[model samples]
Target: MGFKKDFILLTKPYYCVNILLSLSYLLAKKAPGICVYLFTPKESECELDGRETEILFFLAIVVMIRTRKTGSVTMINYLTSSFIYTKIANLILWAYADYLYGVIFGVVFIITALVIPEPTYSGPEHVTYFRTEHALDDELESDKRIVWIIAFYTVWNPACVNFAPIFSELSAEYNLKNFRFGKVDVGRFPATGKKYHVSDSSLSRQLPTIILFKNGKEFLRRPCVDVKGKLQTFFFSKDNIKAAFILNTLYKESKENGITTDEKKQK
Candidate 1:
């Protein structure tokens, strides 16, 4: 399960960076060598110490909390955050053995936070936007020959935001008459989420759930519950999704049939 995408990428990089920088004002200690080298060697304030570390660490926690309190993952976001969390955690573990690991992680985190860019996508995807539960249900039941892939998402969930571009890319790449793509923003339409058993909560493990529909019925869904009812983690990646949904096979089959611009003539 995502669990806010394994508890990372819940906060926007800018938001977290801004918080840390603003909090730096309270630090009256000396900056670490990394910080001094990056910015000012002659530091009057904004230092690093045990208590200061506590505050900054707490501040990092604040980034996570605030992002979650507000909203987590994507293929890019998921991959990036996964790497970050793994490195940071491993750094902590190795830091217990030697201090170098901690130093490296601190330097990198500080540097990355300073220069990390925020998402700036503002275009629309080439997928049908389902605005209501009734419309979704009707569309699903309306066509049996058509295969549908739907992304269940929310506005505040970073995981969804990250996957948003990938989803759009897939739709554009795999556009076909028999094969279609769609999205439902559970944030805007809570009833649709409730009807589909997907939660719109920021902490929901299935915020960016993807399901395949065929013959007016659900054929497959990612992050599905296991035999014990525990949700399984589904990594969002183009290759992963293509294989999981058998996009190549479907694409070939749909391509065999012409792209149906005139549904009337075909039906």
Candidate 2:
């Protein structure tokens, strides 16, 4: 249920905006006279004799601004708000034009509202990492069967941004019941950085540290320091990570525990 709600929240804004734009364009093209009557603020205020197209364009902009301000982008909110606005505009048009035109406009609004589909929701399929230190510690301690691979990253670091897609792909490919992948934004949670010895300062050199934990203990890590104690940033690639950690450490552990490749393939 939580996943369903998240998916709806993430996707509804785009869908609603698209539907509003398309409907506005269709109305403008098909019913220019009606638009000029409905959208023009006051018939006596200005002369819209030769500016029908301009009025329609500005009308679309007005609808868009109202939708944005509402901030609730669900289909129901958009349709209800749009219907009320359209009804008010049509009332104004009716005072100037025939009552039949107002009825037509109301019918059009109702049909369009009914035709708009509610946005669909789908949850993410892969494992995700928590952000805070306590969450990470609790997960590690409570689940002895889960081996965690955590990437400690800072938002300002361009290297971390570049490596994000690679990390995500690896997570989808290699995640298992006993092995999982996640990341922490050290920029957001500085205490998490300090706990893992990840420097959050902009001037500090070390960033994007990847750590492995098994049985609630630190197992291995990337970007080891040099002889002078200066941190080294290793090139983060899928093949490098797979070879260094997945095949070498994780696969070995899985094999020892009788979690064979054939069983994983069947799952």
Candidate 3:
């Protein structure tokens, strides 16, 4: 009952005067000798705690306007509030404010999750780390199983950026909590380049390379040279590139074994 009345008053700002008048009358009736604070006159006329009252009054106005404009309370409202409070608390070192801000931030994030879209991905998450000395050694030593995909590219290549997003999407999709992804900037990670026999010199032209690994061993590697023609022909076609990945990683063994019984059956 109390909540409903406050909500109603929130919408009809004019009702605030009547509500305040009723509150003052009740307080006067309960304590006849005590002075009562009645809501009257413009905010400039208020004598006690005028600043606090003004802030509250302004907040109420903002709420009224936003509610009318949006037609519903939105998660963005809470998120914006939380962000503001957090920034204030962090800069001001206000522990109480920080605590409240943290709570609001968490609550707002939950609300946002109900409406915001989750990001999607396009390919295998882990890529090779080819440019570090003992990169493979470190992976082999780690207790966890790791998947690696290494993209080989030259500094002069203009086509790499066009393919970067699709590759990132794939990585996002496949990047499991336990699994990891790494990039071997062949130009930067010289040892990685040497380990993979990739050359930075113009003569070698090692751009658009992918190497996959599991348990520190190189399971699959797609050298830029191997698919030079195909990559150039369908570099921007996600489906084509994705199919190529399937061919290299998933169907490598079948192709090595020659025409399988499944293919014979299909034929």
Candidate 4:
């Protein structure tokens, strides 16, 4: 009875089952029996059981390859597979394959769960920025009349390291003819750091702080404070990272569009 129940459960397609079956065949000392069953009007023997077992055993290797090449399935995908496996495994009758599957499934699960990708930088989607002083001058002087959002970043700060790619993606998104994105290494330019007022005592602990300039006059700075308030005050609470990024950019845009009243108006 248990053997029949377990056999039924094994027919389901779930990652854990596939992984466990694969591991079991891999660990077996003798080759599994090459039995074939005919399942059609035409009498053709298909080695379904053996082939499936072999495919399952090789699933981890394929996963690793995919992860290296494209990327691992996201955490949610992994969890969904785990749940499907759990449901099928709960109904299994033959305890050995189920037990082995459980163990091997656990191992592969942990391995994938622990894997983390290397950090990368992705500037905004549609934005483009000039890197050199000459290019900056050229763009500013050109008929395009670009607004530059320069990412001043260092590689060292963990916060900056994490934010760099995100900033890049945002830059790319906002990249257009009227506006552009650029990045500079603050560590490479001490004079530029002084000129931008990006330093340890005040602004960001991260390497890449965002600054907006029009015709080379600084309009807005972030992760930095103006006379009004600290930049972090607008962003840090409630884990509102997306909001922070949007608000910061919007503030700059508002000033550029002449929506901002001068400090004198507020006073």
Q: After superposition, how far is residue 82 of candidate 3 from its true place, in Å?
A: 46
Measured on C-alpha atoms, candidate 1 has an lDDT of 0.68
Candidate topping TM-score: 1
Ordered list by lDDT, greatest first:
1, 2, 4, 3
List, residue by residue over 1-267, the lDDT tens digit for candidate 2. 145744555366544543454454335434657556655544343333334445445656766665444332444344533444544454444433446755765576566557764343232335476766678777878766668888888866645654565677777766676778878888888898889888878765556788888888888887777799877656566677787676456755744565456755665
**Model 1 ranges off by over 4 Å:** 1-47, 57-118, 122-124, 264-267
- Mind giving the per-residue lDDT tens digits that candidate 1 earns over 1-267? 246733454376754663343433232124455445544566553344475456447646655653442223333353433334434543453354348745765676678655875555545567999986678888887777888999999976767766777788899889877789999998898898898889988678887899998787889998799999998877677778899999988888878974466773656
The models' CA-based lDDT, in order, is 0.68, 0.61, 0.45, 0.46
**Which runs in model 3 stand beyond 4 Å of their true positions?**
1-132, 154-156, 224-237, 247-267
Q: What is the lDDT of residue 158 in candidate 3?
A: 32
Model 4 TM-score, all chains together? 0.40
Give the clash count for each candidate.
6, 0, 13, 25
lDDT of model 2 at residue 191?
90
- Top-scoring candidate (lDDT): 1
C-alpha RMSD in Å of predicted model 3 compared with the true structure: 18.3
